[model samples]
Target: MIIDNGKLNKQQRKAVETTEGPVLVLSGAGTGKTRVITDRIVYILENNLAQPWQILTLTFTNKAAYKISKEISISDTSFKILNSKELWMGTFHSICLRILRRNFEHIGLKQNFLIFGEDDQKSVLKHVITNLGLDIKEYNPFVWVDKISFEKDKGIQDKYSNKELNFDKIYTAYNAQLARLNGLDFGDLIIKVLELFQIAPDILEKYQKQFKYIMVDEFQDTNAAQMQLLQKLTGNNFNICCVGDDDQSIYS
Candidate 1:
């Protein structure tokens, strides 16, 4: 239920207002991307198509989410009512943090665990290779530790496909380090959630029910981890929409 702003052509109109199933919006610049997103939320609220509780929007950047919020508020204040502190619009990492924070206590966290970005994760890896008796001189931890992040981006753990090993001890030690410190590195966010989902279907089901309309912005840029996450969010009900220029994807 998106407003047919003069900005969207007929095809764009279908992409914007599409109310059911998986949707892929492939378009280039000047194709009214933000305009369509803004109008879509506007249409949903204005037409009463979705209960204020059911429309969940996911954006790639916090800045983008804020902008969408600002634009939608212009149509009516009721738009403010849909803001899901844990469910509505936000970056993948940001939203995952919310979910993790909710369940952190179950995992023995005494407080909200820290969410590390890429730079911080590198430091963790560097420390692990050094502290766990690996020869950094020979290992060149810096050269390959970044792979952890990339692998996590694709939802990969130790890859049998790649056939790299000998770090079982080091890997466990690093995880122990994060656990002792009550922190999570950037890669942990998605990978941890995937683990939690596997172990806790009930928890996953809770989120699935909570986010009624699953919309992903910049979807083509998403990697394997994010692609799996998208599936988890949408469930089998198919109330999902993905908008991105597939040609622009780097992880592909």
Candidate 2:
């Protein structure tokens, strides 16, 4: 298949066109990872290998997704997946929010659920701790939230699912409060999605079979929630593509 050579470097070209299982484009900075990504996607579509709906692509940042869109828009000499009017790109969070919202009712959530940022999360945690007879000051609700969130990121459920968690009462209370408020933080989004997948197998099966190809950016920075999501979504033989630079993982 032909690609606009002026748009992509050698590494990007190879990684993009490689239709293998869990392809990882590993390199340091300035390696045209984005170029390869767009070209690869275009080639896949142009070659009639996959459709727009069958492909699931994610970038680390919305800016990155925007850049990919701009580059692909410029290289119009190649194939196009969506119409020129369409934009099927964004960060992991954006993609998951769409998926979660659409399948919310299956998991006991509202379609218009609000996503709580850090401040909202802390506020809710504060109240949950108070209700559970815990001192928010001594335990530090903010610090507790961050630490507890780390475990959730690692695919570890709180007392709600895993009984051995020391802060089970607090975590359970925190989740209860979030549900009452019709809100979820970034960590809750991942954790709830995981929870939904576990509780609602039918919903998971529908999505798992829908996207034939899954592309993930920044593989090295993948948290437990992301890894587990990928694991649950992709079959042993499904096409999975990941691009990342390992040394760039700074702690949250």
Candidate 3:
């Protein structure tokens, strides 16, 4: 095999060789987790198990994604997998951005809508709070931002619940301002994608079929919303490989 995983330990080799069904690798730090994932990807391409586009590799951070992509590309220069344009390798948010760009209209967003950063999000919230005649001291901008993020992560829309600072009102107005600006906050990435998939079955099926094999790095860190998105993507095929160490998991 050109994608030699000979140096991998016994457990890592097993992970690379098991190219069928759902596979989970739970190991401590410095156990060559990334190596096994990259090797498995290369093994799939080399063995003609699936096309590059059919393989979906997800990472938590852009740096890890880039590193994996780089390692795979340089693993073997002769392999055509490097030239495959269908390769889907990126962070969850980045992958969702790509999907949204193509099908944003279904979710009431333009294809070219803006993604607001922390500063812009706070600015928008401040505007909404100010117009509502609420003091920022009582309803701190950071607190409100975190509250909205928490709710969005749970796939819940801000209902006008009666609260001391009227958080519901602020959230509603904040969303209105975002809509007017044609923008979405950071937390909206996963939430919007989940919403899109739930509302549009055809779109979900399209991706589910396109990606035959799904691989997730740092699986333990996945939040509830991310897990929901993964479930939607892996409907029936269930060719998923999750690699992580629960012992080292800082987030659940």
Please provide, for model 1 over 45-135, each residue's C-alpha lDDT reduced to its tens digit, 9 standing for 90 to 100. 5666676556677787889888877766555443454443433677888777777888776555557688666566667767888887777
TM-score of each: 0.86, 0.87, 0.92
Q: Which stretches of candidate 3 lie over 4 Å from their true place?
A: 156-165
Name the candidate that leads on TM-score.
3
Backbone steric clashes in candidate 1, count: 0
| CA lDDT, every model vs. true structure | 0.70, 0.73, 0.84
Extract clashing residue pairs from model 2.
none
Compare candidates 1 and 2 on TM-score and give the better one: 2
Each model's Cα RMSD: 2.9, 3.0, 2.3
Candidate 1: where are CA atoms >4 Å away?
1-7, 76-87, 156-162, 165-167
User: Candidate 3, residues 1-252: lDDT per residue as tens digits?
Assistant: 335666778888888889889999988887888777888888888889999989999898999988888887777645657853468988888988888888999989976899998888888988889999989898878778878877776663445334545866887899889989999987788888888988999999999999989999998888777888898899998889999989877664
Give the best candidate by lDDT.
3
Ranking by lDDT: 3, 2, 1
Better of 2 and 3 by lDDT: 3
What lDDT is obtained when candidate 2 is compared to the true structure?
A: 0.73
Higher-scoring candidate on lDDT, 1 or 3: 3
Kindly report which residue pairs in candidate 1 clash with one another.
none
